[model samples]
Target: MLAIRLLAEPERLDTLALPVRPARGEESRPEPVSVTTALPAGVVEEVAALVPATRLTGAPGETYAHLRPGRTPGRLLLVGTGDGDEAAWRRAGAALARAARDETYITFALPDDASPAAVRGLVEGLLLASYRFRLTDAGPTPSLTDVDLVVADPATHADAVEAARTTGRMTALARDLTNMPSSVKNPQWFAEQVRAAAADLPDLTLRVREPADLAAEGFGGILAVGAGSVNGPRLVELDWHPAGATTHVVLVGKGITFDTGGISIKPVPAMKLMRKDMAGAAAVVGATLGAAALRLPVRVTTLAPLAENMVSGSAFRPGDVVRHYGGVTSETTNSDAEGRLVLADALAYAVRELKPDLLVDLATLTGANAVALGKRHGALYSENDGLAADVLAAVDAAGEAAWRMPLPADYVEYLGSDLADLHSSPDRGAGSVTAALYLREFTGDLRDRWLHIDMSAPSWADGDDAELTGGATGWGVRSLLRWLATLR
Candidate 1:
């Protein structure tokens, strides 16, 4: 983690400078302008003159650097802030951080027009881009440690800066958990981590149900999914309620530690990235922790049904019917679609017991969703327009991309099964929507307040880029946290 501190002004210290520029044309080099008006008068002009105006356009991720000739040689980094929106600023911060990855200490000033919220986004981008999972020492240690955030009004933006710090920390935690290999991060390990996290949070209460408890409580969906793995299944519930909080929001996450596609096995290549299938659970945990840490004035309950979907004689197979928590029977059409199965039990439990005013479930449920929304955005489905609008607003505010997808009532028939109440979608078309429709059956009358997010794409990244350095992106944490804040 980068140690970030707010600075009222830039002193006479040798630091890496960050100057923003507008995006460049396709044929031209970027000529970036100085968004660092808050920097000392001569610093911006001096840095701008160092790079040729037409040599580099100020495009996002575009970088230009020069070493000033002096007793103390200082590095100047010019980054592009394209449209100067929250996303652009975050990209600019990421580019700058990536460019200065080897530095021991780095300093950059926020743009003058940057709001407190925008400043937070900038910090998040920088931290996210600098992130590297080095648990096994396969990569070099991170050189950049201390970061100085130059702000014109530190006193006024203190609260926002602190909030950004908390959000960034939580996001990183989620990413770390998501990036862990399945060999090390089974259902028990996940439960222990959540327990430890909840112990530190004063307002949060932690509950873990082992395999016996799950069986006794009739969480058949979770049990069936984990029947093949040597490690048993677990259902973890975390609750955070503040004083005088009236609105209750329940977050359910699918916790498939490693998905092998069960008896309906997937291709070898597709199975490689299955370790990140639990990203939804990690996001919900991170969001819950962030809300508690920030002291948000809303009650939040997080439910994660943790399991491993493996191939074995004991594994639940196709044509098998498993009754979920609310006695909703689902016939398995494809075991690879097991994420929704585990989530089915959790959603039903949340609805029956928690009775939240709003219910949102996040899952890496389908490749069809990735095909529909691509890797850059999560697919959000909600029949209720008002709920969709609120979630979209929060997504915009958090700068996490999510496209609203439809849940047509007619598509519910795709999940029809003669053997059970519902069946997992066998067809490839509209698979994401149909999966959501399947889960909706468990919500009972609470369907109006339900929102399903298929985050199969955005939850993990394939390669290092400007905003995120590959691996787990912690996709839903920011949006969930922002949505919770609005409820206050």
Candidate 2:
């Protein structure tokens, strides 16, 4: 764990000025720009002149020049983001993150006039951008170790700074868990790891539901998904209820410890990365732990449907319809599409049983999402504008890549079934939307207030987000944490 020391004063951020600016066409030079936005235009001009550029000139996600002095060891990064809007702020953060390498420390000299939200957005982006997952013996952990934020009032930004650090920790933990092998992080092992992480936290309760409990609770999705594996399955429940929480948030994650595609087996190449199928669940547990550690006032409950989707005589087959917790029967169209089956039961239980104020489920549910957003961004689908907007704002503030995707009403026809209440998958084209639509059914009317994150691309990355060293990137933890902090 790397420690980034933050302070509210400008002394440290200002004292490290370079003597000479890097000239154009200069290789290995630092680009230093002053961040300016709607609220901080004055400081932008001031910092811009210092870099021989106008602070108000850099476009969002753009940079002006590098500050490479003769004596300084590190370069000064000048990131351009439009007026301190949340989107621009997040872009600036992404710019900084993209500029960092694993072994070095990067510092952001923020505009003194920016709002507290903008400052939070900037730091959140940097931290998320700096993340990396190195679980194998391939090489050492990433070098981008520390990030320093030079702000105006450290006291005023205390809450945001702590929130960012906590979120970063949670995301990192998720990445570590996702990067491990199936042999090490099987269903039972993963649940125990989550338990161990939460044991020392105050006011936090952890429960692991075995197959019997799942069966008793009518969680057929989890049972059938894990039934094929020798390792079995688990339902991990984590709860945090602070003193006066008004909004109760429920997060259900699809934790396929390893997915071999069951009886409708997948190609050998596809089976290799099934271990990371649990990335969504790992993300939920990590976010839950982060919220509790931060002691956020919002009541939080995270349900992870943990399992191993493998092939065996016991594995559930395609064309089989299983009744879920809320009595909804789903015709399994494709055994490979098992993530939604497990999530269906979990989401139904969360809505009908827990009746939370808001429900959000994260999963690497489809390769379609990956095809749509590539690895740079995660697709977000929501039936509620207000809730979706709030989540978008949080994602913007956190500097994680996210884009709003629609859940078309007409697409509901894709999930129609002849045998059961619904079909697990729609016929091919626009698969991502169909998957979102399928999950929407389990939400009932609550879908109006619900949000679905198709994290198929982010959960597993091949180093596309330079910060992530080609493994589990711990994608959603930071966004969820930042959102929880705002509720508190």
Candidate 3:
């Protein structure tokens, strides 16, 4: 964990000739200073004159300039954000986070007269941008250390600090789970990891419904998708029911450890990054752990359908009809469309077994969503207007972008099948909506209280960078956490 220390006085920033003043027990600190629209004009001009142009431009993303503070063990870094707009400031913050080290300290100097809202926004953006998955520390540790926030006195800013801490922890957990490769985080490993991570939390209970249990219970969707792997599938449940809870929020994630598109088999190049198919599962477990740590009053139940949809002799094939947990049958039109199948059983289990008041399912479900919304955002489909509004607000608050997607009632026709109760994949057009329709069949009992989040893009980045690490972004956890808190 990165240590965050707060300093109040405005003079503290200049006294150290760095963004954040040094404190006792901290040997070396990064001189990296991120400026926003909140930055004073004089400060921006002065820093701009000192740093090189190339560093100035690149500083918006990943470049840094070194500054000498005479006796201070570390160097000062001036980060430029072009016009200093809010988005620019956010990018500048992400750039600093992407450049930070575990050993070096960072201080974000607030503007002299910045509003409380701006300060809060800056801290949230910085924490979200700085997230990384530092699991075993198998590689070199970071030299960029602590995060310092120069603000008003703690007495006046206690709420801001608490909010920052909460968001930071949420981001860290999401990053940790998303960063793992599919090889090390398959269905069984995913369950074991969740158990180990939350073992000491008395408020949390982690349980894995293994292959035997799933088979006996007739969870054909999960078993069919995971049969290709030697590791097998599992339904991981993490429950947190605080005393005197007012709301019951249920989260279902599609945890496909590695997807080879099943027997429908994706092209080799198209299937290379299939490991990230389980990002939705990663988000749920990560959020559950954070919520337990936060000790929220609302009762939270997380259900993850863990599987590896690979191609093998035993793999479920196109035209195969699977009997899900709800007693509904699905004709596999495209084995690549396996996420909804696994989720069908899990969602059914959530409503039938846990009986939560509301349901939200997250999955990297369709390529159509990426084509529809692009990267940096996910598609949110909800049956109820109130839930959609609440969810959109939470996603906005978390700064993890999401757009509300329509689940067209007319597209229900595409999923109709003659041989089975439903078709897993309909026609290619409106593919994302059609996929949601298939999942809705299993969720008919609770249509008004369900949300489907398609997180296909942010789970894997196309480029190599520190903040993203070219792996999972753990996209949905913070949004889910914020949403759950609001429910209470």
Candidate 4:
């Protein structure tokens, strides 16, 4: 974890300077000493003069470096913040952290016009970029141990700073869980981790249901998916409720520990990254714990169905029909589409037993979502306009990208089956939408209160240089946390 602190005095430490350029058509050189009150007396002027000939355009994620070589050894990193908006500040912060990875201590000089929200975004980006996951290897650790955010008024921004820290910590935790190897993180292992993480939170209550319990309780969908694997399935239910909370929000996650596509078996290249299939469960656990850590007034519940889709003689296969918790039968058209099968039982149980006011389920369900929205955004689908609007607002505020896709009534026809009530369509087109519609069958009357997030695109990154590093990005945690904060 990155150690973060709030500094009242900027002159105390050697810092990385973020200097915003004047807008186009402005005066070439403003007063050096009083350009803006954001920085210490002459910091901006010093940087501007050091690199005079080169243009100091304040584009987000842009950097310029200056080093003094005499008796007074010092380094100044100039970062750009175009428009100085929250989004720009976030990118700038990430760029600054990545650039200064060799430094032991660094401080960010906040701009004069920076809002509390902007400060939050900056802190989030800094901590996220500073993350390094090394469990057993004796590799070189991150040089950055301490960070200070130099603000104009620490007293006024205290709450926002704390919120940002909490959110960053939770997101990092989710990423760590998702990045773990399947050999070490199977169904029972994941349940134990959740139990231990929440054991100390006084406001949270946890329950773990093993295969026997699931069998008796009629969670057929989950049981069917895990039948072939040696590691049995488990359902983890976590609840956080404050004393006077009235609204209830339930989150369900699909935890396919390692998807071999079951009997249908994926290609070798696709199977390599299937360890991250449990990312949705990671986000659910992270968000629920975050709500409890913040002690939000709203009640929250998380149901994670953990399993591994492996190939064996007993494995579920094409043409197999399984009945869910509420007796909604589904024919398996493609065993590669096993995520929705596991989620079906969890959603049915949440609506039937938990009876939440709002239901949001996240899964890396379809590759079509990635094809439709690309790798930058998750696909969000829901029939409820008001709920969708609130979720979209939360996504914007949290700086997590998500695009709303239509759940047209006509899409339900694709799920029709000759043998069972429903089946997963192998249609390459709109695969994401069809999967969401298939899960809708088990949602019962809570369909209007339901929102499904297809997170295949944003859950895992493909490269190290991107804003989100390669591995689990913890994509949904921040937005879900912000949305939970909005509950009355």
**Stronger candidate by TM-score (2 vs 4):** 4
Q: List candidate 1 stretches off by more than 4 Å.
A: 23-45, 51-54, 71-73, 111-113
TM-score of each: 0.94, 0.81, 0.84, 0.94
lDDT of 2 at 151: 61
Candidate 4 C-alpha lDDT tens digits along 373-463: 9987889989899999999999888878899998888777888888988886546468898898888887889999999999987999876
- Tens digits of per-residue lDDT, candidate 1, 1-488, equal 88888887655346655655653566654443545435544665666565565366566667777776672337677776676677777777788778888788877766666677667767777888888887685767768887787777787678877877877888898898999998899999999999888888797899999999999999999999999999999999999999999999999998999999999999999999999999999999999999999999999999999999999989998889999997989899788889988999999999898899999999998988889989989999887899899998998888788999877877877888899988875574888888888888888778999999999999988888766778999889989988989896
Model 3, position 46, has a per-residue lDDT of 54
Candidate 3, which ten residues in sequence have the lowest lDDT sum? 15-24
| CA deviation > 4 Å runs, candidate 4 | 22-44, 70-73, 136-139, 426-428, 465-467
Give the poorly placed runs of model 3, Cα more than 4 Å off: 9-66, 69-75, 78-90, 98-103, 112-141, 464-469
Model 2 Cα lDDT, one tens digit per residue, 1-488: 44555545332332132112233344533233333212222433444455544433455555433444553323445566565676576556656666555336655556656666766666656666666554456865556666666666667777766776677678878988888888888889998988889987889988899989998989998898888888978998999988899999999898998888888788999888888898899888898899999988899999999999888888898899989998899998688999999999889989887899889988988888888988768899997888888988887666577889988788888787899989887785888889888998899768788899999887877755433546788888878887887885
Note the Cα lDDT for every prediction shown.
Answer: 0.84, 0.76, 0.73, 0.83
Give the TM-score ranking, best first: 4, 1, 3, 2
Cα lDDT tens digits, model 3, 219-267, are 9999999988888899998998888998898899988888889778899
